[model samples]
Target: MSAGAPGGGSLDPVPEPTGGIEADVRRLAEYIGGTERRLAALPPVPDRAPHDRDRAVAVHVRARRARRAFLARHTETVYGVLTDGLTRPVRLADLVYEAADRFPGLVPTRAQMAAERRFVQAEKEGREIDQGIFCGAVLRSPTAGRHLVETMLRPTPRARTLLDGFRTEGRIELDTVYLERRGVAGHIEFRNAARLNAEDDRLIADLETAVDLVLLDDVIKVGVLRGGTVDHPKYRGRRVFSAGVNLTDLRDGRISFVEFLLGRELGYVNKMLRGLLTAPSPGDGRERSVGKPWIGAVDTFAIGGGMQLLLVLDHVIAEENAYLSLPAAEEGIVPGLGNLRLTRLTGARLARQVVLGGRRIAATEPEARYVCDTVVPAEDMDGAVDRAVEALRAPAVSANRHMLTVAEEPLDLYRAYLAEFAVVQAERTYAPDVLAKVERRWQERERRRAARGSVR
Candidate 1:
């Protein structure tokens, strides 16, 4: 289970740094190369016996630990070499393979390419790179995640396809997200009706593309995020807002940290907050994002990621019966950025109830008033969204918004928070006992459903 130098000396948490960047990188590269050989020596993961697989995983964990720790210290130097010092900035999807090819043991392909996805900006290769693993590994270094975030802020190629035709067609409909321009307001509807509008690998790329269209479209002055109608029996014919990040996907190992978590946050989610950037910004971060106001219309419920989405909105309209909660307690993972951003909206105590205690805050509750700008009957959501959009779309609103963002949450503050999240959330995602607990909770829920069915 030990990942150490040859002949059995455990690699220290951080390999010693040699005098120059070249020597340090060389030593670390050699250390990383050893991890690759050790990984190759292990039994193949899929066919291994249970015990063998467990030991293999342990070995891989050690290898990843050493690699991530080394990379954290030498992130700039390592990435500079990997990507040719920005001459050939590798897209996130190609980063790991490039590392594996160049350094051989820097980042293992098996460890990085586990999760999957699609879309223009997010996925280039088969199975969207498990950026959750890749970015999560290096994001603890301040610049790596920030650089990726800034990179993602630039328009995706698909955004150009949609934006070029945006005024002509007035709408771009994708498999998981739909964006349409209505007057000065743009509505981006979450379209995974069959899945209660929960986020997954497939939704991330499409959602960001939709976000990009809204940001890039000159005709649209404001943005609105609402869920589409769902096929679920309970919410049939009704927009359910969102069911959160798909718990089934997370439990089934389908959620990627990069796509689901960071991609969601840094991609469209952050874009929702920071607005669109026309170029990659390396200096004077203040002048980078050209943002517009956004409104969230919550219909039936907003849970976990759905609830996290509300924190970024300039205004929120919720149906009287709608409820929002972050079920981090149940999922045994961070509820995206809830811990970092929720308290700003709901205050510390109430935010803790939603995040830690998993309390569902109904729209009708007095406390819920702070989270949502307006709570009306389900029938009033449209009018509420219209009024909110009209008010937000004014020219003065943009400047005032920048003022608010500057005073409230500075860009670097958000970046620092995500840096912490990048590391902690990754640990939560791959922690051994966490998934077992999640599976057991799922089993218990299924048992309760079965018992209820038998009783009826």
Candidate 2:
């Protein structure tokens, strides 16, 4: 039905609407609603193979994306209406459902609604519809996606409650993440100690809270992100930085799109890039909050997701012995924005090696310099971070930092990339071989774990 729709020959951009905004919205709503209903009423395919199911679901997904992109074309006109005058405080997780509830001619069925939100764990509750079908469709819309991103940036009620108390407490600690003001810097330590600070669903809230504290606090002028020491025998008592996404959780189906994937990118990670959306960025009114510069201190290794993050940080201070890699192929999922950003850092060829080839380049390797700013010995990391903080503490630094980010890659670029990324990542996350790959990785992890225990 559309150009970008799967089984359609092209991934070309959806054409601009030829009709009036109001007329287009009405007509497209009817079309999209009818399409969704037809998709929902299709005969069940639960007994089919994985790829067969995926093929069936992909058609619905592509159609949904086309509808999302169509909405993007008219976002300026229809957005507020769909979102009910923008008075309600809706976060990314709940954004679409609110819209669907408020309006019609969007996702027709409850299962379609679940797929739109990527709630894989929640039972379908309907017929044999695939959950990944429309997971990122809403996010694919430019203004709508940014609106969701901005919504996520608005301080959470819990964070605001913690903030008032945290101002005086000067420190807040959660099970897997903690925030403390160190001089002029708000330091956030990733502390999934038993898992080497690997990222997962459980880490998003606490980590995001820590990030919110830094951006909202009056005293903190700069931010620092680092990994905490882990309990794993091989890396016991040594800060392992980030072992990247938790394969165990990923394999076990514990992760989700809105809560984890979209949550990380639109919540904490992008929060670090764009800052808190206190006043919103829709009009001439300037934002009340400013984006803060962060210095990432890497120890040991930053794999997959961690390496993707290095691209966004203001300064990356890596230990001399540390290394980095973006093994996206092995993980069977896109490495967030790495494909879009890594080329700027390492160029096309090297980026291909890192992302496609899964090449782990150590800090000593000259290629690693492209990703990290200063490689310091483990003992000197604290001093290097302090110096970076002191240098970045200038009030005007954020102005230049945001400018640099835009110059390197505009927000529109990120917006457009994420539109497609939302769909692709959802699809790949459920790839047939992914669980098998995770099983292999799990086996290797256990073998290594056992070997370490024996050595101990």
Candidate 3:
């Protein structure tokens, strides 16, 4: 049998090589060299602004269709080459590099953002947003790493399914939270306005669920967390971003201390930081990030737990009148993950002052700039958010976000601090001293309310 021929008879003597393995290797080298030369010769992709929203939508539709076809044919090979049993970060970086090499301009840019807005408007008018085009850019774009795709490939957990159901038929009807989707942005509003938008157990669960839905939705690229207007007669039509945890529930023993800690740590805070993951199956506790960017729209106040939650967001746009504080020290508890994340934002000394001293940080203060990306007048909030969302929708935004998070606050650091926070917060929640302090604060609030004739 000839050496180059397949299915030679076993008894046949081995034939001399007709340009054997070396020749095959040389051929591969030549092919690669030719491909590289061709790629290098190609001109850079041109940039164009859509004349209008409809034109933008058409551009996205065509690009997404092309991307989907490409991925359908190549995804398995890409996954095998980039993500088999690799550590998440390495896998992600390699995938980004590879995608950028293989498919330039695959990631949607500003054009896609305009298209998404049009798509969202159509959906509101009873047209279905095309799922086929929703995540194609994510795969084609080098900005989204393989870790995100791998996470999506896993089966959706039942808990997550239930949470998603809360927004069935394009509307979320929870009493404590208001959820709305605008183009590629998801808005989650804390709706307990009568209590100054303070988070109670139910509100915590609902808010967590809302965040999960945002993470799960492939079409949503950014999420905005804001608060609703105050419902009290005196404060009617006025904004109250959040007053933090519902101290009344804590004082009256209406909420479980441990459950509150878990809900906040895992449900809200962790979900924002690490993204959502299904309950780990036995022997598989590996966590995956949801990979969605979050924006905080602080209108009036973000106090205590509210302030702590802001640490998890990718960006913050606070109203000029907004104020933030972490007063857990006064209440005899460590602020949830505040020490860890706050120190990174503000220096250790400033973090200590804010957490320990219960210093209220006005939005206009230079210190507030450490936490918030921008502080705009309340009237400009809508415009500011629009600009911020547009900025976030850029092609490389996801890659930039991932690299920034990994470098600035690695996942391991967050996990370690959260572990300590869960245990310490649970113990401190019901401590006699802590309870006494909370009760005293509650009484003081009541006295002030009575003195004001319950105006506030």
Prediction RMSDs, each to the true structure: 4.9, 6.0, 23.5
TM-score: which candidate is best? 1
Clashing pairs in 2: 140-419
Give the alpha carbon lDDT tens digit for every residue of 38-150 in model 1. Answer: 55565544455666555555555655665555655667776677667655545565665676666555654654454332222112122222234456645555656556556
TM per candidate comes to 0.85, 0.80, 0.61
Error of 3 at 293 (Å): 0.9
Candidate No. with top lDDT: 1
Question: Which pairs, if any, clash in model 3?
Answer: none
lDDT (Cα, tens digit) per residue for candidate 2, span 1-456: 443233323223423456476566565565555444444444444444565455545545555565565554555455566566665557765655554554454433444544534422222222112222233544555656666656777877778889987888888888799888988899999999998899988788888888888999989999999999999868899998898889887765567665777568877888888788788536631355568899999999999888877888999999999999888888888898899989998899999998889899999998988999999999999999999999999989988887787788776677777767766776666666775788687779889889988999
Sorted on TM-score, best first, the list reads 1, 2, 3
Candidate 3: which stretches are off by over 4 Å? Answer: 1-159, 162-168, 278-289, 445-456
Clashes of each: 1, 1, 0
**Model 1: what TM-score?**
0.85
